[model samples]
Target: MYSGQSIAITGAGGGIGRAMAEKFLAQGAKVAISDINTELVEKTAAEIGATAFTCDVASEEAITAFIQGAEAANGPVDVFVSNAGVGFPDEPGGHAAGGSNESWELSWQINVMSSVYASRALIPGWKKRGQEGVKGRFVIVASAAGLLAQVYSGSYTTTKHAAVGFAEYMAIMHKADGIKVHCVCPQYVKTNMTKGMTEIKEGPGKHLEASDVADSLFAAIEKDEFLVLPHPVIKDYFQAKAADPDNYIGGMAYRAKTIDKGHIPLQ
Candidate 1:
C-alpha cells in the first residue's frame, strides 16, 4: 500500500522513528526523516536511504520548514508520522504534580502541540486530496501512559494524554477531510527514552524492540485500524481501567511505590 508514496517521520535519528522510516523505505516509499539532532539524523538518512531534515518539533516554524523541505525532496507527503517524543520525571516533591514548569511546558510542546502543528500544516492539502478520493494518514506515537499512567513522570503522562486526545480530535473533526488518524500506545519499547530501564520479562507486559513497534503500525494500517497497540495487553488494561476506576487507581498507587525499582528513566 505504501509503494512510491512519500512518508515523513519525526525523531528519526534512532529508535522507533528510524524503524518506521526503514519499514516505509522497504515498502518502496520515498521517506523523509527529521530530528533535532542534525548529525544523527543526517547519518541515519545516509545509512537508510532517506532524505534528512533537522527539525525541532517544538517549534511551529521549524516543523513547517521540515514539511516544505520533505515535499521538495519527495513530493507531497502521503503519511506524516509525529513520532518524536520526550519524557521527564517528576521532581522530588510530596505531590503528583512535582515536575517543574519548564519540564511540563517542554513536554506539552513536544508531545502534544508538535502533532497539532503538523496536522494544521498538512490537513489543508490532505483535504483537497481527500475530495479527489486520495486520503492521507496521520500517525502519533503516544504511550500506554496516556491511557494509564507513567508513574514517576507527571509531565510525560499528562502531555501524552493530551497527545492521545489530539489524535481523537483529529479523527473526529477531520475524517471527512480525507484524514486518517492512528494513535500508537505501547507499554514499554526499547528506545532511548527507555534507556537503562530494566526489561520486563514476565507477566502480560514485556519490553519490545523499536522494530516490533513499527511492525505493529504496519499491521494496523493493513487492517485499517485507528489505535495501533504494539503491546496487545494495553487494550485489556485500558478496558479494565474503564471498567473499574477504583481498582485501577489502587493498582497504580501500589505500582507508583515501586516504580523506582526498574521503571525509572535513565535520562
Candidate 2:
C-alpha cells in the first residue's frame, strides 16, 4: 500500500527513525529523512538510499525547511513522522521539578512544538489533497510515559503528555480534513536514548528493538488505528492506571523508590 508514497521522518540518523525510514523504503516508498547531525544523517541516507537533510527539530523554521525539502525531493509528503525527541534526568535530589529551566524548555520545544510546526507546514497540503480524496498521515512517536509517566524524567514526561494531547486535538479536529493521526506510546526501546539503561530481560515491559517499534507502527497503519502500542502490555497498564489512580501511584512510587537518579541515561 505504501508503494510510491512520499514519506518523511525526523530523527532518522539512527534508531526508531531510521527503522521507520528503512521499513517505508523497503515498501517501495520514496523516503526523506532528517536529523540534527548532518554527517550522521548524510551517512544514513547514503546507506539506506533515502534523501537526507539536517534539521534541528527544536526550531520551527528548520522543521518547515525540512518539510519543504522533503516534498521537493519526493513530492508532497503522504506520511510525515515526527520521531525526534529529547529526555532529561531529574536531579538526584528526588525533587519532581528538579530539572533546569533550560532542560524543560528544550523538552517542550523538541517533544511538543516540533509536531506543531510539522503539522502547520503539512496541513495546508493535506487539506488540498483532501479535496482530491487523498488523506495525509501524521505520526507522533510519543512514549507510554505520556500516558503514564517516566519516574525520573519530569520534563520528558510532561512534554510527551503535551505531545499526545496535541495529537489528540489534531485527530479530533481534522479527521474530516483528510488527516490521519497516529500516536506511538511504547514502554522502552533500544534507542540511543536508552543506551545505558537497564533492559528488562523477561516478562512484561521488556525493552524492544527499534525494528519492533516500526513493525508496530505499520501494524497500526494497516488497521487504521490511532494508538501504536509497541508493548501491548502498556494497554493493560494504562487501563489499570485509569481504573485506580491511587493504587497506580502507590505501585509506581514503590517501584521507583530504589531507582537512583545517577543511574538514569539522559538522552
Candidate 3:
C-alpha cells in the first residue's frame, strides 16, 4: 500500500517504532528513521538500509531539521509518523501517582507537544504542494489510555488524550487540503513501555504484540481509517464509556482498586 513512498518515522529505534519501520521498508518504501538515541537509530537505519537522523521530537528545531534533511535525501515525505513517547515511571510521587510536577510536564512535552510540533512543521510544506497526485499523510501513535482512563498514570493518560484530540482537529481542518490525519490508539502492546506491567489474561484483553499493532496500522493506512485501534476490545470499551460516563467512571474506579492491589507487590 505504501509502495514508492518516502516515509519519516520518529522513535524508530525500538518497540512499535522499529516494527513499523521494518514493515514500511518491506513494502518498498524508503524510510528515514529519527530518534534521540543516535547509536540505536543509526544501527536500525544501517540494518534496514534507511536514512537515519538524531531528533528530539519535543524540540521544534530538532524536528524541523530532521524533516528538512529527510525531504532533501528522500524526496517529499509521503508519510510522517509522530511516534516518539515516554512512559511515566512507576513511583508513588511521580506522574503515575499524580504527585510530581516535573514528570507531568516532561510527559506533556514529549507525548503531546511533540505531535503538535511535527504537524506544525510539516502541514505547511504539505499545503504548499497544493492538490498533488497523492495527499501527504500524518499519523500519531496514541494509546488506548487516551480514550479510556488509565489506572495510575495521570500524565500519560492526559497527554495521550491531547494527542488524539489534536489529531482529530487536524483531520477535520486539513481534509479539504488533501491531508490525511490518523490517530492510532492501541491497548497494551508488548513493548518497552509495558514491559513490567501486570499481565491481564481476560479473553482478548491480553497484551498485544508490537508486530500485530504495526500490522493493524498498515491496514488502517490502506483503508484511510481515522482511528486505528489495534485492540478491537478498546472500541467496545470506548463505546461503553461514552454511553454512560458516570457508570464508566464508577466501574473504572472499582477496577483501579483491584489493579492497585495487584500492583503493590510489583512495586
Report the lDDT tens digits of candidate 2 across residue range 93-204.
6699999999999999999999999999999878877346447999999999899989888998899999999999999999888789999998878889888887776777
User: Model 3, range 1-267, lDDT digits (tens) per residue?
Assistant: 678788999998888888899999999998999999999999989998889999998798999899999989888898999999876644664444553678778788888888888888888888888655557899999888789976677777788899899999999999988999889998777777766667665666677778898899989878879999998889998999999999999998898767654432212
**In candidate 2, which residue pairs clash?**
none
Candidate 3 wrong stretches, greater than 4 Å = 89-97, 130-133, 260-267
Off by over 4 Å in 1: 130-134
Tens digit per residue, CA lDDT, model 1, 1-267: 799999999999999999999999999999999999999999999999999999999999999999999999999999999999999887765478877899899999999999999998999888877336448899999999889988888888899999999999899998777678999998888888888888886766888889999999999988978999998989999999999999999999998886655677626
Clash pairs, candidate 1, are none
lDDT of each: 0.91, 0.92, 0.84
lDDT of 2 at 155: 98
Candidate 2 ranges beyond 4 A from true positions: 130-134, 260-263
The TM-score of candidate 2 is 0.96
Backbone clashes in model 3: 0
Best candidate per lDDT, number? Answer: 2
